[model samples]
Target: MKENRSREMYEEIKNITKTFQPRLGVIKDEKGNILTESKQIVDRWKRYCEKMYSSDSTADQQEKLEETREDKEINLLPLRSEIEWAIGSLKDGKSPGCDDI
Candidate 1:
């Protein structure tokens, strides 16, 4: 259990230490499961920085960029129903039951 916790911590720290240009894609876990792949999230950060530093970029361009980014994000992948259902159940204070289907 300690080893597992240590590995998880290391993974989290490794993620925190990276500095890179934002690319649109999913980040995966050790088991190749996606942790986050929200293009909207990445777009928001870029837009914020641009708004602060790149004063020449107009609002119309930003709005168009947002629309393109959103379309990419929506089409990149879809979540499994089981995962969504379980998340909803936990959020609603209900138990997630196992499905044999």
Candidate 2:
């Protein structure tokens, strides 16, 4: 019964995806050039992302890290009572996180 339900859901999702149209029909490059081909669009996206991420200044990052190190101080872990209180305050019926616990 569970397997049949899972199969039905998978087929439903597949049918839905078949009817979907991609929103990004075309992409524009930084030079205002329009890309229609799939390869051109993908390459343009890759170059754009690379240029964007690479534009960050290493000197500014180092200065920011140094400022953070000077200002913040490490703190000890919470008490057992505090931990229990936090867990107890969580509402019931909430879904488990990534660990599924």
Q: What are the clashing pairs of model 1?
A: none
Report the Cα lDDT for residue 26, model 2.
97
Please write out the lDDT profile of model 2 over residues 1-101, one tens digit for every residue: 47559888988889988875768879988889899999999999899777656747556777899999888876868899999999999889886666543
Winner by TM-score: 2
Model 1 bad stretches (over 4 Å): 1-55, 60-64, 73-77, 81-101
Every model: Cα RMSD to truth? 18.1, 10.0
Score residue 100 of candidate 1 by CA lDDT.
75
Considering summed lDDT, which 10 consecutive residues are worst modelled in model 1? 26-35
Winning model by lDDT: 2
